[model samples]
Target: MSELPAGLVEFLESAGWGGAAIDPIPGDASFRRYFRVRHGARQAMLMHAPPPHEDPAPFLLVAQWLTNNGMRAPEIYAQNPREGWVLTEDFGNDRMRDWLDDNPDAEVSAYAGAIDALVALHRLDPGPFSPYDLAAYQREAALLTEWYCPAVGLSVDEEGYRAAWDEVLSPMLARQQPGVTVLRDYHAENIMLLGDPREGAPQGLIDFQDALVGHAAYDLVSLLQDARRDVAPELERAMLDRYIAACAPGPEFEADYARLGAQRNAKIVGIFTRLYKRDGKPRYLELIPRVWALMERDLAHPALAPVARWFDANIPDELRASGGGTIA
Candidate 1:
């Protein structure tokens, strides 16, 4: 039995499941922890977000918003925001990756469902979320130099990197048409496959606490260009086509998607490196190469020309991936 936090124990007791068996679920990069609780015939998942490090308000608000929007987010059974704990419906251990692994033939349908969910989400208004505007995008893109460059013993002109990114991203962000809510981490791991294919919300969304207002294609980039898993190129193109046809976003959508994809992957590269150097999680280092590849692919788009030039000048092909901090 893993040690439960003091507040979590109290919250579970107040929720009438004090003595329930707690099975710790594997966590991601965030500070939030999940546990599957079973008492009698009832089962529920407890989300414990330690205060000062994390909060449950955004998760609760976004979950409610997604549910209200007719998409399937977890149902909050009970919540103690002050204590940073919430009990939500456990949609089982069937992750979208599970379905994709178990039934390879259903990849097309599964991705289609995800894209359709995004289309539905994009149509709704971004209630009170922060916009992923120019400053926000540039700040996130800076992570590459902030963490990754120094970790690999490579020198980066931080000012140059920022200037190049600004040149490309400023106009893109300024021209962004609002309305879509960009779920910051809309990848396979956070998406759960639930219910029948023909039914409502075949995809159950989680880890959307950081949802923000941004381009409709932002989440699409997050989904198709996942850092942890491989989404085949064919599926990527098909889903992009599906979204374009359904939304009719305009001719600039593809360019924006590619640009965001580059920006997002660059952020991930730094984040993964930071996870190892700062957070003491070395496993994320292995994914650095894959993320670099995705970044390269996205930079092929003309919209990312300036950003690509910065990378070519600073981070060479050999220095792209981490050397376990041994390259001096």
Candidate 2:
């Protein structure tokens, strides 16, 4: 168990849950830490997101934004910004990842609910979040060279990588004129099945502190080409068709989807490598090959020809499959 940070009890007490049994939740790749707090029959989640490294404000801002816009971000019960502690409504252990594993029958409806949530979120004007602009996209893509390349004992064509991204992403960026609210990390693990018994499986959103105003297809890519788990190709196809049918987007949406999918997966590959090499966390390394596979799938699209060529020239086929495992 992690030790309690100072003044945590007073913070909880002020929030009317003093003397609560605070049990730590496992940490994710970020610096934030979460805990389940229970005081008699009442319960809530305690978020210990120490600042200077992890700010609770973005989480608070995005949560409030989502709730106000008729979405399902966890309700914030109390907060201490100075110390970076927040008490929020707990969604329990019903993550869509585990929910699908136990209830395979509900996979279609559950994913439908998730896709519906994205559809609804994208329709509204984004809240006061920053734009996921071209610069941001390039910076994220550079993670592959910055972190992953060095760790794998390979030196990639850094300039070529940037040029390739610019060639592919410029057109995609143009197609997403005036962005929408994109939950940057909208995958099964971060989504919870709320079991509302409605036609769509209402989900509870978490880990959306990184939400931004971006392309509609970006979140769809995150959902369908998830690194944590493989979304069935058939289900992925059905969902894409469903989203296209529902939104009636521009003709380039699929191409944009492929482009953003490649970008996001490449970013994850870098991030997971950073976690293992810099942060001393090996678990994320295990997911690298999966992300590489997903990125390759996206790169197959003509929209990603430049990036695909860079990978072919830079990384070998054997490395793409087992680069993460090779780190040790």
Candidate 3:
């Protein structure tokens, strides 16, 4: 086995896990790393962020918040904040994406469960977090110009891009009702299908340290308009209808959904491009076409005229082709 970080190993020994086998788990895009600890009749997941790079407090805080809300975030077993280590209940390997792939017929029921989880999540107080207000939305959407444009060798009217988004999104932001806890990464990979959906049992959630107070439609869009996988159009529509029926979010909810969806896709396209050109992770580029396709659908909404205009003026059809038209 490769040598574990000295600090992490010391933490394990001090925490009475010296003999437990530490097997590294696949990591995500962030700086954090995960390991599965197997000891005699004991199993847990260790999240090692290696401080000065990543912090554990936000994850702990959100975990508490989710647990308090009766959602199924992992239960924290032990923590060493200074070392950036957190040992929590292991949810095992049954990711929602894997489950969906293995049992395609369960798509409806699985998504229905996830939608029910959203209904429950929205019903709770959002706790203390910054609101996903107009400025935040604009700043996030700016990634398209800030990163993706330069990568594609396209010049952007950065000022005009922000202005267009402000014009299109200002009124929508103003009309937004009280925000709910928006799990920023609510797609299939972060969700674990833990139990039967028919029984109304909640599912396990992970990778939600960046939870924020935002529109109810935000997480719904994250799930349906995934950057990694293709959620069938029919399933996406059904799940969306399910959430609307369950939550009955005010009359303007559909517009909010489309707006947030478009905004998120814009941010992701830029991020994926940045990952390839800046971080040397090219595989994410493969997913841009799928993400941009979703963006097109969302931008088609009449409410997104300004954003659509920005795209038209900046990113030509050829520039938007898969792999982002030669990032040379």
lDDT against the true structure, per candidate, is 0.85, 0.88, 0.86
lDDT of 2 by residue, 1-328 (tens): 2488877888998999988998988878888888899999988999999978988999999999999999998999999987999999999889999978888888888888888888899889877889899999999999989998888788889999999999999877766668898889999999988773245647899999888888999999999999999788899999999899889897889999999999999999989888888899999877888888788889999999999999999998788666443764
Candidate 3 on 115-196: residue-level lDDT in tens? 8889999998786777888888988898888888888788879999999888878877655557789999998999987765
Which pairs clash (backbone N, Cα, C closer than 3 Å) in model 3? none
N/CA/C clash count, model 1 = 0
66 in model 2: Cα distance from truth in Å? 0.7
* Model 2 vs truth, CA RMSD: 1.6
Q: Tell me the spans in candidate 2 whose CA falls farther than 4 Å from its real position.
A: 196-201, 321-325
TM-score of each: 0.95, 0.96, 0.96
> Which of the two, 1 or 2, has more TM-score?
2
Question: lDDT: which is higher, 1 or 3?
Answer: 3
If the candidates were sorted by their TM-score against the true structure, best first, what order would they fall in?
A: 2, 3, 1
Error of 2 at 274 (Å): 0.5
